[model samples]
Target: MGRMGDATRTVPCDAVAVSSIIETTGLVMEFPSTRALDGLDLRVSPGVTGLVGANGAGKTTLISLALGLLKPTSGGISVLGLDPSADGPQLRAMIGYGPERNVFPDDMVAYDYVRHFAQIRGLPRDEARSRASDSLYLVGLGEERFRALGTMSTGQRQRVKLAQAIAADPRLIVLDEPTDGLDPVQRDEMLAIIVDVNRKFGIDVMLSSHVLEEVERICDNVIALDAGRLVAQGSLDELAGALGGVDVEIVEVADRRDSIDLVAQRLVAGGWTVARRDPGLTVTGENDEEVFDAVVRAVADSGARIGRLGRRRRTLDDVFTNERGDSSDRPSTARTGGTE
Candidate 1:
């Protein structure tokens, strides 16, 4: 069954969290075959914010536009109180970026790369060298600081990119797919570094990823997208709770989901809709004794075997799929407004 009552009563899973940093309006970017980004709008705050989407969904495009690397055909994007289109260099100087792809001077040692960045930031030669070493250590590069970057592994190369970005001590860091190629241990190490970058250095980070679970674990808030459009944006709990509530359906069937059509009809009588039929059907809304009893009577009357029946807690992934998937046949559960 879909839900017991109106899919409007939201269950509070946790407290709320909010922060505001980057903001956009009527954001649009176009290309030859497809509109890379539509009339998109987003609000990104400080702390560790997760920017998530599938490939070609405009996650990369949005970051490029926001950082001044690319301009929107029409729309406004701002970072750290500056417009990237006009003050690209100035804004970038105050913001650091680590791209999804690895780019570095293969011939240069890690020390030289970071030292060069520190020098470009106007530090004296000696201080630049010191800062470079400090950055190397911060990312767990010890004696390998003098090793040529081209000779390094993918993980090591990424660390170099991070080191150079921080050498300038920018207040804001934008990481595009930061954990792209690392294994479990390496990924965890990188995650730890990212957290330390925010907590210890007091820098605000905007990280983009397709790894939904990673985003949930590390982010304070999320701006999720699908096919280049913003579908849902907020703290994890807030977004998931908006799905209202979730419940598992128990049907009497040697095959639990076989006779859902009959049960669906009975559920419709009680103002419930059948959301899905899998291990069991998923119904929306709450703990309704009446609905449970109704389901029992229907199943017993139909001579269906009584299988497992329970409620499943909604998760961030569930909320993401439900919101970003097709909406033509579905009803929205109320939401706050966003910029055009």
Candidate 2:
């Protein structure tokens, strides 16, 4: 993982190499019946970081706590170098929030709606109007800025929410399920806009979503939560490494189960971990040679004709699935860290 000199450091595991833009230590949030967050400790870097988990994974509650909209039962959090609990206004001014729900007023014009929030957040009237217009354009809503929000499509409304979140030019924008209700095409568009918001505008983003593909596409780092505990946190590469080292998959020819079995047996004898999966066998080793040599020797010895053999990088979906198994085990309330 690449390291930046900023306060935000990339965390592969428990050891902190540098400070983070957002840091939480022993953060806990308790509801009447269950805990929304339990001794949660997380560190986030400045780039786009995807917060991913199953439904009710405390993703929303975590964002709310970071925004200072909800108070944690205990622990500390720092966002943009300031404590969210202590310096709420100051910290919030630097952080824009887009909730999962559509909170926009149907009657208001898009540009006016965005400008009003900017003004409320301390921007002068004229400045708010200017920034709102600019942000709307940035989010590809320039043509629809004058239109009523209620008349727009779901994708358009989502864009409007994003525009308003960035209207005040906050240092960090927290997006909760930004692609929640869009179709595939609209989802792609929204993700593109998110990429531009971070890359072109040089703004930082914390995107929380259950769509693993979206996160995989746009985020440089990911923080996965399960049962209010950090399932994993690090750059995408780091997380992949943590879950499992590099992986290689080999598929045998049609109706060649015996070939794969022999390959697995050979690999295991070579002191390499191998997993039997549908259509193929997954082999893992310390290096490419170790994995490749085993596969080669096994295939040659067993006379197993290969259909496809190559290294495959694990996706966020794989990591999430492997880390948190069985959707039935995930709770609806913070009890199982599924929802909060």
TM-score attained by model 2: 0.78
lDDT for every model? 0.73, 0.78
How many clashing residue pairs appear in each of the predictions shown?
Answer: 7, 4
lDDT of 1 by residue, 1-340 (tens): 2123433322111111224568889899987788888888888877888887766778899889988878889988877777888877556667778888877878989999889987765466888899899999999897799999889988888788888877777777889988777776677788889989998987888888877777776788888877778877887666644343334455445655446666656666667655766645655536556556666665665556546665445555665667756543221222223111
Give the runs in model 1 whose Cα sits over 4 Å from its true position.
1-19, 241-313, 326-340
Residue-wise lDDT of candidate 2 within 124-197, one digit each (tens)? Answer: 78999999999999888888899998898878888998999988877788999888778777788889999888
lDDT for model 2: 0.78
Q: Candidate 2 — which residues are off by over 4 angstroms? A: 1-19, 241-274, 285-309, 321-340
TM-score on alpha carbons, each prediction: 0.71, 0.78
Residue 337, model 2: Cα distance from true site in angstroms = 26
